[model samples]
Target: GAGVSQTPSNKVTEKGKYVELRCDPISGHTALYWYRQSLGQGPEFLIYFQGTGAADDSGLPNDRFFAVRPEGSVSTLKIQRTERGDSAVYLCASSVQGARRTEAFFGQGTRLTVV
Candidate 1:
């Protein structure tokens, strides 16, 4: 079974530009999540999709961030007007069916640098 995978292991962009981060979850997994990890901090949950719908998106910082899981397999996180403050490692995770004590497997992540 393929594990989670992310694109653009490193992304460099000027402030105010838009960037899209991609995530491919493991096959047969029904739960997918997106998180942001700042230096020295734990990964903060951004959004979660159960199958094809966003089960929880309250963690999304603001309107600047958005995500979509159309086919229940892959997900994409979009950030508008990138900022230096937004610079961090974007992580994607996947689980089996529920979050009940089930750990999520994370990707290598995309290290976005807004310069």
Candidate 2:
């Protein structure tokens, strides 16, 4: 894909259900990140992956939220025991790994609604 691609732009599930959100980053990008945005707020970092390993996942709220990037090209965010408070837009961004700052391209995001 030429840009970051997120599947199922909108997802609605009952409380306690499990959901998996997918993100396909731009080809050749070596860095990927997952973020969450609640209503009226900027995107909050959830996780960051460098290559196939997660370099930073401390931003994830709890054990219920997890993310993985197996091949370094695509990533999946898994949410367990979903709650209404978890409802938010999940954003994915990717950038080239470099010592200098690189621009990141973001996907439109997947809106998860816990009802």
Candidate 3:
């Protein structure tokens, strides 16, 4: 695609349902990231990929959250047993690796609402 693309711009689910969000980053970009934004706060890093490997996954709240980028391009975030606290905007960013400038371009985001 063109810029980053995220699926399910908005979602409403029960307090304990599984949800999957998709993201397609710009072509040829070597770095991809996922972030979570709660109300009245900045985006918090969730995970990052430098290619097919996960460069950083430290910000995930728990083991229930996971993500993958198979071809260093498109990625997906899988959440199991979603909780109300998990309701927030899920964002994706992509940038070139080691560019000194981490001007990450973000997608519109998926607003996941766990009722």
Candidate 4:
């Protein structure tokens, strides 16, 4: 019954700092996704997880971005050496099953501001 949840609704960090954003998906959902949204723009797909494995990680801009869902439930997005350009709203979503047809519910998002 619960929806996707993201922590630290807002984050402020220096250009070279590291940041870890957390997400908790709905119960029994088999598919999870991460997206980034810039000012006035649509959310961009980042990585997707089906069960405990990453199904698609191509959207990650570079090696500095990564995510993990070890036990197939909660996931964490890790950014190494954060840049000012990395500032954006990080959103998480989950679906009842892994399919293009199923609807995915989104979290409020963690807004990261790199100074």
Candidate number with greatest TM-score = 4
Q: Model 1, 1-115: lDDT tens per residue?
A: 4789999899999999999999999888899999999999999999999999999999999999999999999899999998899999999999987568888899999999999
* TM-score of candidate 1 to 2 decimals: 0.95
On a 0 to 100 scale, what is the lDDT of residue 86 in model 3?
98
lDDT, candidate 4, 10-110, per-residue tens:
99999999999999999999899999999999999999999999999999999999999999999999999999999999999999888888999999999
Q: Write the per-residue lDDT of candidate 3 for residues 74-108, one digit (tens) a residue.
A: 89999999999999999999987736677898999
User: Each candidate: how many clashes?
Assistant: 0, 0, 0, 0
lDDT of 4: 0.96
What local distance difference test score does each model get?
A: 0.94, 0.94, 0.91, 0.96
Flag regions of model 3 displaced more than 4 Å. 98-100
RMSD of each predicted structure: 1.0, 1.0, 1.1, 0.8
Task: For candidate 2, list the clashing residue pairs, or say none.
Answer: none
How does candidate 3 fare on TM-score? 0.95
Among all windows of ten consecutive residues in candidate 1, which has the lowest summed lDDT?
96-105
